[model samples]
Target: MSEGNKNTNTEPWGGFDDNLIQRGGSAVIDMENMDDTSGSSFEDVGEMHQRMKDEEEVTAEAAATEEEGGEDGEFLGMKGIKGQLGRQVADEVWRAGKRQASKAFNLYANIDILRPYFDVEPIQVRNRLIESLIPVRMINFPQKVAGELYGPMMLVFTLVAILLHGMKTSGTVIREGTLMGTAIGTCFGYWLGVSSFIYFLAYLCNAQITMLQMLSLLGYGLFSHCVVLFVTYSVHFHSLFYLLWLVFGGLSTLRMVAVLISRTVGQTPRLILCGTLAALHMLFLLYLHFAYHKIVEGILDTLEGPNVPPIQRVARDLPNAITVLNATGKALAAGADAILTQ
Candidate 1:
């Protein structure tokens, strides 16, 4: 009882004290390992930031180099050989356009170039006029004599004036504005359009003639129209008008054909060209004759009074059956009005 009792009192807590001491030592070692891991993680983060900064500097240097190289070497957002080629093509197009514009300006703005074509002698004009009137006379005439623009321009203007005067004198119910416009348009349109057509044909036929030459010849040809207009308006005879128109029209056609044929070489070509020209001239003349005659007939009807019988009007050789009906209708209307008033 003495030895066992003494041992129990000395070691009352025994293994529990040993377990507490060992746990405390293990916790301290775990805390030191955590501190070391945290320090290493911080160092890795700093290294990553430095690597990003270096990459950013490299990218900035590349961008600066491209900008400096592009300043003197780019065109329209293109680069290198392609850009240089584009610039050259653009320059060539610009130069070509500039040259064309300059040529057009010189052609239109300079009046002196046209002066030579208009400087014609009165005797020359008279001779050309005579030749245009008589187809036979133009046979031996010099081709150079038909190169004046003044005579043609004057003749066209004169024809217009004469036509207007005839319309006024006829007392026809035509608007002056409309009549003047029509006369000017018909005369000038025929002159320009036909002359251009003939010139094109001549070119096709290999005839060495200029545009101004064709214009001059066609312009002078208007003298026949002036003569026909003057005589028909003065006489007021339907038969006389037709006679003059046929004769003068044939003469003009023959004259034009002769001149055109002289420019050509081959017999078959000349014949074909002359035939075509004759047909064209005759058709043009016929159109003009019909137009003027219609006006003249209107004037005659106005002067003769509304009571003139339809049969008598028909006997006046009205060109259109519709014109006869119009006259008959007008006469009937007048009679009906008279009967109503009475």
Candidate 2:
């Protein structure tokens, strides 16, 4: 029984050992087959590595492109920003220059021109004057009038007055003849003086003046009595001189009004011309008191003897002088209206 049991145990243990050897041999064969397989060779591993390297390089190139594109976009945005800023700066500069030019131009280059025509308070006067010269551009009337005519016309008028005085004072003519000649010469000198002033004013203002306008301006002296008498005494016109004065005044006023209207209507050139003429007219009126005194004194000294009756000569001369001066003032006033319109 013992031998039989030992044989059975030996048999069972030998079978178990054989099974273990077969399983181990199968695992070794499977491992060797997996190692030498054609489907997973070193060349396949190398191809996989090459693909990963290629993918890495593509990723780096894409990153670089993205970085370059970001830079390009930033550059474009900066350029656009700079261009917009430049335009804004240029516009501001241009506007500043225009404003400066405007501020430099003022009416008559004097504050006294409107004093005779307007009776507004001092504060109002300055305000009105500033209003009249609004937009104060260098091209406005005051600058043109002052620049072109002020000095030259003064010099010319002075020369003419001296000549006229000399012509009558040389004692070559009789007293009556000298008086008449001096009167006529004085009238001519004054007319020439006014004409030159107007012409210079027109030239600077770019006005299209006709010969008729010049004649009308010269003939305006005929109505001087009415203006002075009417304004000074606050009297109404009733006489023939007064009627004549009214007609001339109307004509001059209408002409100036038309100029102002044109300017307001966007006729810029016409407005500038009218403004310049008006400014010069204002300046001329300023000189009238002094110039008239000097010229009249010179004429009287030349015509009437030094011992002649002062009252009689003055009485005779003053009325005519008043007549001319009144007309001149009216004309200047008309010119001012035109400038205001511009």
Candidate 3:
């Protein structure tokens, strides 16, 4: 018999043939180069399978290590996506910071409101504060610029409220904490109420607006009201002035959401949102004005005896029935009399 035929007949089906294995596989593997620990006994098919599994695991780990270093990745004709994605994120942040700083100082000059501006630069903060007073910046940059401006800007308006409050209680003897607390509370509470309503509407529309942003812009709205108050301190603000600023504040808030979700929110939903926010703003302002007397009186009554009158409370509560007619009449007269006597 021929050698090949003799071997084929003599060898059993399960017997090892390194030549058969080498020929059947798609790739060549040098078994001689395999480590000594991997059993060299190829006679047993089960032992050969275990050795082959160990080699596969070792090769896979080595490939993975090289892939992490980007060598194997390139060898497979693929670029490192992780590095590219990281660079994209870093570039976006850098550009956003620059854009925020630029727009903060030059709002009218720039018309874009696509970017959400946060992380205001120190030098840009003062400029941003001034820009926020203008309707465009207040509405457009509520998230990035106006949000940070809330703190110091509200502090200024709160002080104005405090001063007007002191003017109201010229003759009254009350706890300083009570007076300060009322002014601070009224100032902050007003923002809280207004922002809460706006936040609810924005969330309903699936907008990306946040409570902090809403509060900050509401604080800016407070600045407008406080300016009106400061200008009319002697006579108190007219209802028309209140109405105008109310319209102003509401439109600004609605515009802010419009800018944020211009593509997502529909016109019908936008109108509904506007109507809801307008109602909220009107009610919030009405509550502040009409309820001021009762609120102050209650605080005074809470702090003192029930006998304490609202006029004898802080100046913030001097408005009788929330009307501008008799509102601040006593406080204004007191100021005039004190000036005339001096």
- Top candidate by lDDT: 1
Residue clash pairs of candidate 2? 102-136, 102-137, 224-323, 224-324, 224-327, 225-323
In candidate 2, what residue range of length 10 has the lowest lDDT sum?
142-151
Candidate 3, 277-329: lDDT as tens digits: 55654565444443333334334333353333344343444333233333434
Model 2 local distance difference test score: 0.40
Each candidate's root-mean-square deviation in Å?
A: 29.2, 35.7, 20.5
Clashes by residue pair, model 1: none
- Point out where model 3 deviates above 4 Å: 1-130, 136-146, 149-177, 236-264, 282-342
Please rank every candidate by lDDT, starting with the best. Answer: 1, 3, 2
Q: Pick the candidate with the highest TM-score.
A: 1
Model 3's number of clashes is: 2
Error of 3 at 85 (Å): 62
Give, for candidate 3, the lowest lDDT window spanning 10 residues.
13-22
Please list the residue runs of candidate 2 whose C-alpha ends up more than 4 Å from where it truly belongs after superposition.
1-183, 196-206, 221-226, 229-272, 279-342
List runs of model 1 lying over 4 Å from the truth: 1-109, 136-145, 171-177, 298-327, 330-342
Candidate 1 lDDT over 68-135, as tens digits, reads 66553222222222222333454466558769999999888888888988898899888888888776
